[model samples]
Target: MTAITKGAPRAFVLLRSRRRLDLLDPDPEAWTDEDLAGGLSRTMRWGGASQWEHPLSVAQHSLTVLAIREADGALTAGEGLRELLHDATEFMLGWDCITPLKAQLGEPFRALEARLQTAIDARYRLPRWTPEDYALHKRADRLAAASEAMHVVGWSRVEMRKTLGIAETPLVHDPLSPCAFAPWEPWPPRVAERLFLERFHALDHAHRSELRKLEPELRSSLVLTGAEHAAS
Candidate 1:
C-alpha cells in the first residue's frame, strides 16, 4: 500500500501497521510505536555481522544505551526517551549503515534522515538536548558501541581501540543482562521487538505523565504573561 497519491513522488513503503510511509516526505503519524519497535528490532547493526547466531539489532542497542544512562543516574522521562530513540531514523531507512558508508551516502541521505528524525521527535514530543546532555549522550553511545564491538561483533579490545578508534574500554558486563535473554547474546527479532516496545511504552507513558503535570503550570505562566501584556 502506497501513501503517495497521483503526481506525488513514489518513495514510500508499506509498514507492518498497514500504513504507508513516504521515505522522502515522511508523515509523523503514519507509523506507530509498534511499527518503530518492529523495524528497529529487524534492523541489524555492525552490518549484520555478529558472533552470535542472530545479528545485533538496533532495538537491543538502543536499550543498551538507555541502560547505560540509567546505570549512571536517574533520568527524566524526556531524557530516557531521547536516548532510546537516538537512532530511530534507521528503522525508517531500513538500514544501519556504518560510519564510512554513511559518509559515502552523503548529504541527500543525511537530509532525508534529518527530516524523518524531525517527524519522530514531533510524534514523541521529545525535548531538545542541551549541549551538556548531548555530550553525555555521545559518551554513552560511544561506550555502547565499544562494548558491542567486542562482545557481539567479535572484535578484540585492541581492535576496538586501534582499528575502530573507540577510546572507551569495552564493558565486561552486559547492560541488558537484566532483560534475561542471555548475556551478550543477540536476541531474535521477535524478542527484540517485544523488549523494545515494552521500554518505549514505559518511557512514553512517563513522559506523557510529566507533560500532564506541567500543563497547569504552563497555563498559569501563559495567563500571567497575558495579564502583564494587558497591564502594559
Candidate 2:
C-alpha cells in the first residue's frame, strides 16, 4: 500500500523504501537547474568516490556540463539536453562512487544504467546522444573532474601518500569556489525549468544559423535527412 523510510513515506527517493527509516529523497521535478549544475568537476578515481558539497550535489554537475557545452556554442536544443541528461541514468541507479564507475561496479551495471538514462531522455522528448555529443560531454566532464578534485576531495598529494599509501597527481585550482557561483539558491526549480525551456527555443534558432555556416555537403545532408526533426 505504501513505502516507508525511517517510519515515513519515501516520496522523494523510490528505492530507499527497504531501508525502513532513510527518509532521504531527492525531488525529481523540484530538481531545478541548480540542483543539476556543476558536476563535470567530478572524477572516477582508481577507487572512484562520490562526494557532495555545501548545497551542491552531483546532480549539480550535470547542469554545469550542459552550460559548458552551450557556452562553447552547441546550437542544437537536443545537444544541450543531451549534455544535461548525460548522467540521467544515475538518478535511477544511484550515484556511484569512483569505485563503482570503474570495474568495481562492473560493466553491465553501467550499460544498463546508461540505457535507462537514454530512456528517460526519450520520455522527456530529448534525443539520444550522437558520437560528438558523447565526446563533447566527456571532455567537459574530465575538465570538471580536475577542477572539482582540486576544490573538493580533501587531502593534498603528500597527505594522500603518507596517510592512504597511494600516489597522487597535482591538480590546478578553479578560480571560483563551489560557493561563489551557485545555480539553485534563490530561484526555485520552476524558474530553472522555464529558463532551460526558453534556451531550448534560443538554441533551435542558433542551430539553424550554424548549419548555414557549415560546408555545402554537411548542410545538404541535413536537408536529405529528417529536416523537420532536425529543425527542432
**What lDDT does the true structure give each of the candidates?**
0.91, 0.47
Q: What TM-score does structure 2 among the candidates reach?
A: 0.49
lDDT of each residue in 129-223, candidate 2, tens digit only: 67876787777776655444444555465765675444434335332233434422222334333444454446545645554576597767777
lDDT of 1 at 120: 90
Candidate 1 local distance difference test against the native: 0.91
Model 1 steric clash pairs: none
Which residue runs does candidate 1 get wrong by more than 4 Å? 1-5, 178-180, 227-232
Q: What TM-score does each of the candidates earn?
A: 0.93, 0.49
lDDT, model 2: 0.47
lDDT leader:
1
